[model samples]
Target: MTYFNKDIETLPIDKLRKLQNERLQHQVQMIYNTVPFYKQQFDERGLKPSDIRTVHDLHKLPFTKKDALRENYPFGLFTVPVSDTVRLHCSSGTTGKPIVVGYTKKDIDIFSEVIARSLTAAGCQKGMKMQNAYGYGLFTGGLGLHYGAEKLEMTVIPISGGGTEKQIMLLQDFQSEAICCTPSYALTIAEMIEKKGIDLKSLNLKYAVLGAEPWTESVRAEVEAKLGVTATNIYGLSEIIGPGVSQEDFEEKGTGSYVWEDHFYPEIVDKDTGEPVPEGQTGVLVFTTLTKEAMPMMRYWTNDIASLYYDKSAKRTHVKMGPILGRSDEMLIIRGVNLFHTQVEAVLEHSTDFSSNYQLVVKREGTMDSVEVNIEINPELYKGLLKETSLEDVLQHEKIQQAHKMLTKKIKDEIGLSMKVNLASPGIIPRSEGGKLSRILDLRSK
Candidate 1:
């Protein structure tokens, strides 16, 4: 019920659209006159900034793809001089040079404001202490959440990421009420808590804001149950102003996260056609930085797959965006059926004997590709059912054998694929070291 900016968050929908239109017009003109990449895009389409007077005309402008950012390289897309900007952050792409983004002082303020809003949405109160576990430095997750929590007037413990011992120590000693990190890393912390036999009540943690990678409700359930916190999804990408782009309200839970539409206008478009899809349908989510000064991106393609819709019965008037299913780039085509790791996560969540820690390994057998899922059994279940047996001898256990067969059949019935399942003991599978965990290991190319 506590909103950071209640007026803006509860503004009338009609007024919200007007605010977006006005900001969009100014943003279009600013980018058209400033950034050459956008200017060239305008020229190629024989369109002027005036042509984009409203959100409806967004379709007329060509989509700004990630390739444009790479082609522009460092500072090429920046609208202001480097001296005028206060900070710079870039993507951690494995190949080629990383895609750099600049932020002016005012833009940094915008970032802080959105993050404050996000933290508030995640049930972070003004006086609550926050243990920021997000990575710092070139990655924006750390600093972005740091300043925002401060903006929300909460005490901050800048632990950054990794070092589970230190994280737990701070959580217990400091009695921080909130924690922010990737969901996978949250699970790692939770699993460590169990292995070390740390009493959940020893930690005063109450809320967890998890993002950076796509996750499922199954992962959320694990984090909440283990940490004894109300966990919510906080989604954002470096290209679109980091982790405050949208946030799931603590009370709202499974509905969806509210997209702060007044600043960053959002649209769901067809991944292939680049045309806007009907409201409430799943597609690639795109955004235009309506209020950004240093790097005002117009129709920047996020490549994240999700749907946008208005929750008429929601607390906030801003549009709500569904959970990110998967990125178009990360999706896999097995045989003919498309698959996202989340689909498998959903099945794992329902299975009482399995833990959410899992990996999908895709390999080529002859000419066809085969997927094998290596998942860990619940530590408690392992302790009760097969503590005497070695992990390699797990399949020899009759209950393990039955669970494996049931899991495989469930996946086949639900996901429409018969994938080989390997049930490993807890700690056998790799855990996230306070970073984004890669669930899919497609080794076909290698």
Candidate 2:
């Protein structure tokens, strides 16, 4: 297989560990001397940079949470001056002040390198045309993919996001070989193609690198089957340097994405205790940017729940991380039962009557938490149902009632949670328009 950087990608485990240790020590010393937040963390813990000479000592360092970034505001945590940094990116900050991160020229180059490696892993080749559908301007996804595609010597369309008509138009006209986008948006494109009766053969798209939101294997199967492309996951956060920290190889399929441990040291820790978890067990994923220069984060708690393990038969020596199950904060506890939207998705995936476009609505009713799943019936199933009854009376149809009863029972049996299910028309549910689509609506907070 063609690799962007085969030497580092296939490095020996011992050598990779040693490289991570050296980078970790340098990063610790740099943060200790430069950023006051890290410096204070060291002093408050009664530790010094010298104490962290290897990756094993990383546990001694305090976990850097998002609250710490917000407290720092604009550039308080940055090691270099803003003028010296090449670019700045920030969160949407809908809830509060946006957490901003800066990148130096070197940092930007490293970002491109990792993304190039990711695209290569996702079955992209040099000279292939890549249509980047990620949003640009401050969101990291757009330019991150653009520069990396360019670095891989692939022609990038830089389409940015939205404009479904234009996205489909260019896919046919340009005959792009690869596409980068969120999984939901890719589904939207696939749906539009079906509605417009666009022949899949007219497009040259072969690979899809999807991320920025947690997705399930069902979503991958849907996108791949509809778009006629191999869908792979590319994972990263702006805090850790965009969407290239790790990537799933197209050939490996469902195994796991390989984390580039040389640049970013990863660890899985207990969500509540903050202690490291046993290998191959699910926990919160954490990372320390070993080579980041502008905003090197040490043990940044991603809050994303996933497990890390090594695949002995894999091509890369780096540790492989399972698909992000769900964010610990985003997980819902309904009436004493913990529920992740993906768990519900897994249940629905087994049934052909419902579409993947579904939402979980959580509400509090007199101190009792209730969850209602809003799911859209598959268009084909809806048509078959409509033949038996009118649209207004479809909910009363015998088949509809039977399917609903089966779904409720399956969810209760599989997830151990009883949830109300609302089956709607094919187009009633909202679809993503080239952006991260939230699947859960927690009205309890509102």
Over 17-49, each residue of candidate 1 has an lDDT whose tens digit, in order, gives: 999999999999999999998999999999999
- TM per candidate comes to 0.98, 0.98
Worst 10 residues of 1 by lDDT: 386-395
The digit string of per-residue lDDT tens for model 2 on 1-446 reads 87989999999999999999999889989999999999999999999999998899989988999999999998999998899998999875578888898999999999999999999999999899999999999899999999998999999999988999999999999999999999999999999998899999999999999999989889988999999999999999989998899999999989999999989999999999999999999999999999999899999999999999999999999999999999999888887787789898888775787899999998999989899999987888888878888889987788878988999999999999888999898888888888898899889879
For candidate 2, the lDDT comes to 0.92
- lDDT against the true structure, each candidate: 0.91, 0.92
Model 2 ranges off by over 4 Å: none
What are the RMSDs of all candidates, in order? 1.1, 1.0
User: Model 2 — which ten-residue stretch has the worst lDDT?
Assistant: 90-99
